[model samples]
Target: MRSTPRKLSLTGLVALTATSALLLTACTDASQSGTDGSTASTDGESSAAPSFDPSTIEVDEAAAALLPEDIASAGVLTVGSNTEYAPAEFIGEDGQTPVGFDIDTIKAVGATLGLEVEIQSADFPAIIPALGTKYDAGISSFTITEERMQEANMISFLNAGSAYAVASGNPDDIDPESLCGVTVAVQTGTIQDEDIAVQSEECEAAGEEAVDILQYESQADATTNLVGGKAQVMYADSPVIGYAVEQTGGQIEQLGDVFDAAPQGIVVAKDATDLAAAIQAALQTLMDDGTLVEVLDGWGSGDAALETAEINPSVG
Candidate 1:
């Protein structure tokens, strides 16, 4: 018989939550320093970059109130998201229920604005197209890129960076340089994809066979390949790798510290200025009241937090 695909179900949600609570308690009490021993140079001093500024931007209530007449009358906003990204967006063990830092943050924002929020799950790359007349916005763990910014309006949220995951015991200590001739799996069209492309170029320049880059539609797929021994390393966001490692009971180890920072955000149609403004305002309220951090912390993503910022550079 073919085995069933690994999926999160409601029962799994309960188990995961129970496991998370225990892990959180241990983590909180460990007293060990929080730093992962990673540091970078800044003005001759080495320090870790601060997470995204979750409060540096705000929305003008007057402008927000000027939302399109249709939107104001409807009083509901439909958001597009892909639940494959854990800690950002994901389905609870109760497969039908959505739960994650992103879900909580968006729900809290909607509550603050008295707007009904609906989540529509779509493929990661299809989110932008799903917006506009059909969907009002998307809050997937989408990273802001110059190319994508040209197609939609992105409201910056979390700061992320690429990292690699390898089987436990870290047999190779898998650094980017170490990946020269190995097969590395990455999600297509993501910053991790770009990072691998850069690595491939560097490998070619060094006379090594450029790393064999394998593309997967989702992190879970890539991770499956890694566990099945089809791939040597998986390239993805650090937080994502961390979550996967946690879920696997440390069966995997993340290596080669953050290489590049990617700023994640919500995307709206180029013409949804009013909707974007309202969202910006709502996010500000969440930040000020500490609800944003609380929601993220609840999901074991205390590291994936962001500050509110104004919606400038209108989508149109």
Candidate 2:
């Protein structure tokens, strides 16, 4: 699974007594805003759409030559991102152009490589498998793992980890560990989904009732299930969990500190060594010139910034 960013006031989804009209409105709003179905900034910043203007950084001719002939000739770097992940990647207020730290940072990398960037929104789980064929790169918050490394190369950019959220006041008495019979919601195709599955298997192995895992195509749907009491807890990247809790007013609260913190990378196809190197060089350039830090700071995600770009860093 992949993660992105948001926070908004509680809309009473937790109140099962809420009218159908309200639920409809929630669905409508979610569909419009895309990720987490809210426009509220997770960082307590302005509601106005944040904009990123990558510096007019010059491209290194040497770096540009590393691109594959097809891409180099086209002069455009096509990227796939699950735009529903906010603060990281999401639909702008205009609901057309993509925005967020990932989008901005990738755009900056493209600028540094002297290529026009075309960000195509895709399913989070599908992004990885689509790389090389459909996308030149995948820019969603794809946590670098050994399993994924076998399929593609990951260039480290930022660090984050999994976190859990439950209804405010721990109403369900959910435990982050020992989740044996709990109903958990998570986005399909994410590491969180895999983690929960492993835990469920462990439960069954230990003679306990297996967890009831609820999977959704998007984190927004999973979050909605959580707030609606359909699921006792939700797991996502720390930033996403934070955003959900903050956005829901007092309806939800973070269950535990982030765990398994690791680097998230810009994914390149396994065979695309040259493209990966090019992106790594471009990211290093951004880091050296401070554009990387600027992009992270702009989205209130500076805390997760990496000091250096690593290609296929040890997941251990």
Candidate 3:
């Protein structure tokens, strides 16, 4: 497969030019949430939207006590995430506070543990590697995979899978499985990115034209290219594709059911076993208290809710 780089990753691009080119990428997140493009109210009307009011949640004694000694004393859970992933984690309308189902859920978890949640944004791929050093945990819609579980403990929190999308009516008739010569767009360092790269190699070995795989820094840029006719198909986490289709006002359409459905987890450093247990307990408390349901539903991602927050659930 031919790899294409976005302006943000190309050093030759002028800084000013790269800034404008990466606007959509820097502002949006890739996690799929089936939002209807109306997260904010237009007129003066009430909506059962998500509210991350820390004051609303009270601390659970048992959960709090479960926290590691250092974390319990510090009173904070430093989380690293790619804030540009929408519905899961993203910048709020004011363009300052990070808000989304992921943010709210983590805050709720912290509240249960009597800790303050501090979210720090970084590149999605970087977040995983920086755990333990720069972040105590990561909750950026990370799919629990064997490769990832090798580096950190994955505590299952939500369910998600890959989804394919195409222009309305599938103008180019792109097939998810048979994209031998198709120009496909995907975000960098995601499972879909690696998946397509492998598929491209398979196609070439079969005497078919290699797939033209375009990699962008963020899902927003990938979706933009799809809608602007720069690519024939786009693949991302299922909820992400749904949200993109919704935001596009029917310009894009999801191709099929979410496949390879697996648990998306909160990543904890390998050495932070105590902290991981504390987080699992806190998540269970939130799940039982209906906070998890509310946050997911409010963000149009209720379908991805987990029945229980398991530790290292089977990836295959």
Candidate 4:
């Protein structure tokens, strides 16, 4: 982790547009919901349809061999995810299945480890704290930050950058360079929340107006607010903003270039080195075999693919 200001993580362009149809809505409560993984979402059409069977991903005996005895015996890798970000992971149209690139990627990892994958919907902030107990893993697009590494092992796999978007036509005329005193919207419990706090503090320190940050439980709500002309701007992972822009039919536009490019990781318990090693090995197998690119590229996110996966990878 670098000493720079902590950035906010994982919010996206509006998956909900006034002009589009969709299967699910944003959920913000602390309580969690159950998903059967029974269906796929219809909202994210940005990528070519998945061309391969996720269940058919080949198992790597060497990778599977690294799993902890208890996990190996259970034969299931249960993942907890904040399933509201489009294109990465979100609830499918059926509202029961977890869908998105992240979901597919993890499912592939599980298949390689010869384990069934089960994903549960959780609030963005609640997923990590419940790791190792409620969830064996967290597959949310967890931006690798120094702070997070202290609590849980973060294995770097995919690379993503942060970006901002505003209502179409510069409606608020907001400037991303100086967000102080602006009304900014973001999802709760994300790195963005922490980032905005730090930005707001900078505003006060400079005797300027602090950013009126509106933290929503779901990016969907924050997006709705932005489109509804309530919030001036929003920021999140780049893929999400791109999804939102494409889905919204010109309702919003990216405010600036994507910045703070960083690797995202699968979160494993800090003490669960065995599990982490297994996951890293399984990911490497996929990468080596070209399965990683095939899966993510099918989702239109192949651009962010990493050549290698490192456990607790060093980040600045």
Candidate 5:
């Protein structure tokens, strides 16, 4: 199954019980954040030692030359991102500024092209189809897939996997081997949501109780659900699982190992091939010069960093 960025925030769903709603909301209220910050900063990024220097980034003449002449003249890279995915893209403390590693990555890309980046916050489902029209590019942890390639150019960047987590010591006796009849929490529209649907189907096919899949709009809510004993299990992107585990302060523990690794990419418009080439070139420069790894490392996602960037690579 393909993995998508999980936005962590303990938002209380209206349908939840009054007790759970309070518990979940109280756990995490902050949204994601970032801006055209020249300094290394984030709600969780201060922990990455030896702070990254954005001022040190230099423009790549060849990469800038690849930009479409019109865009080069425009002097701004319009980017649409769903500012909800923590450590990747999300609204910051001020409630409007977009902050996260993904924001920083795109900013570095803009700097290489010597253009200002204008990050436009939009819904996750709306970001892709509007590319080339509504936005110049997208970099919100889009997993490179054959289907996505048909819709837009997918430039490979990071490799990430999915993982499951349960309350510490598995106090609920949750079994990853068979989730039949167990509560499983996942963010809406994520690959984990799709995977759990299949698992639920399998249980019914085998005449066993199907999994009680709990869909939350925010991963923080899902993670909080698991913490509050409302869910027996929860699965998300490996980095997201790690972040949730850390943010929750030992309330949850990883269950089993991470699985289903895949390449996540930056989405560019199909018709804007020139812009796509320019983005790929800027990205390659980042990968080669260590800027990409430095930024990701600060976010605890350095291990998922890719050494090379590719365009529309064949998915396994």
Candidate 6:
């Protein structure tokens, strides 16, 4: 019989709930003035939108000014991440040092800007809300989304999507549809969580029992569960699943194609536009110099899908 994965303890649930509340507090002020001179509320807000003069807005200057003297003077960029997401970010073979594609890319970007990079581990979903006054930026394979844009500024650097990792031999053929009535493991409070929720809805619509979506605190835990047969499949980023398959000596296989394409970005405080621009410019330079591709290559991650251009605005 397969060993069952452990459920989150009541204390853990309470802690997560409290952290989510803090994150919500951090995003409460995401409203911005619309170009039509009206106020636009984001997420679930009912307030009127604010208006802005697009003609008078100097994009370059605005982005540049967002990186104020204080941040530059600090000389160190404090980053928050749950580095358990492999290929993107993870502990090295030594098991103590943080290492991965995300770390390398962010380090290169920091070097270009003459700043020191420091990474702090935090709950994946709580990283953004923990940004204010504590961290300078966040680099945990964060996806750029309009909902997130309302609460924080995201400077996209990589094209990413969700995929599955399963035990070899492909016994279950775990596609999204196959996931119905099965136990699927995912990191809690991430885009993966949102994706699984959508899949669950689909299962319900098809008259099948919705999969039991098991939530792990980190990718490492989720992958462990997959190998232990506690879960039918592990859902995670495509690049991450690729790395895991390679590292496991074919013990695992990445199944199916990409399901959701969510561009990855660096997260800065909602009000930190200058810092966002500086990071964006640095990323652009990395792409031009071929450094970005080299970093991804080092981690055995796919490089052809990288997007060199800045896809979103510095501030929402």
What lDDT tens digits, residue by residue, belong to model 6 across residues 36-97? 11112323222221121212212233333445698678877899866666556655433345
Q: Lowest summed lDDT over 10 consecutive residues: which window, candidate 6?
A: 5-14
- How many clashing residue pairs, candidate 4? 7
Task: List lDDT for all candidates, in order.
Answer: 0.59, 0.72, 0.69, 0.72, 0.70, 0.60
Q: Rank the candidates by lDDT, best first.
A: 4, 2, 5, 3, 6, 1
> What digit string (tens of lDDT, one per residue) describes model 5 on residues 1-316?
2334322211111112111233454343222211221112224442221244556789999999999988899999999876655556655544466766778888888998888889997766677889988899987767777778888898877888777888879887877789999999887767788788999999999999999999876554676567667788887777767765655455577887777788888888888889888888998999998889888877778777788888899887
Q: What is the TM-score of each candidate against the true structure?
A: 0.75, 0.84, 0.84, 0.85, 0.84, 0.75
Candidates' RMSD to native: 11.2, 5.6, 7.1, 5.8, 6.0, 16.1
Give the number of the best model, judged by TM-score.
Answer: 4
TM-score, predicted candidate 3 vs. hidden true structure: 0.84
Backbone clash tally (model 5):
7
Error of 3 at 12 (Å): 32
2 against 6, candidate with superior TM-score: 2
Put down candidate 3 lDDT per residue, 1-316, tens digits, no spaces. 0011110100000001112243343333222211221221213221222565766888888878878898889988899977655556666544456776778889888988899889997788777779889999988878777777788887877877777888889988787769899999887877788888899999999999999998876665677677667788887777777666655556678876677777787889988888889899988888888888877777677767787998888856
Task: Show model 2 residue runs off by greater than 4 Å.
Answer: 1-46, 60-62
What are the per-residue Cα lDDT tens digits for candidate 4 across 3-104? Answer: 121222232344432212233343322111112211112332322223447777878899999999999999999998877776677765455567777888
> Candidate 3 clash total?
8
List, residue by residue over 226-246, the lDDT tens digit for candidate 2. 776788988887777766665
Better of 2 and 3 by lDDT: 2
Question: Weakest 10 consecutive residues, lDDT, candidate 2?
Answer: 9-18
| Model 1: ten consecutive residues of lowest lDDT | 1-10
Residue 146, candidate 2: Cα error in Å is: 1.4
TM match of model 4 to true structure: 0.85
Residue lDDT tens for model 1, 57-157:
34335534756677667877788876656546665554455556666667666666656678876677777876796688888777666666777777765
Off by over 4 Å in 5: 1-53
Cα deviation of 218, candidate 3, in Å: 0.9
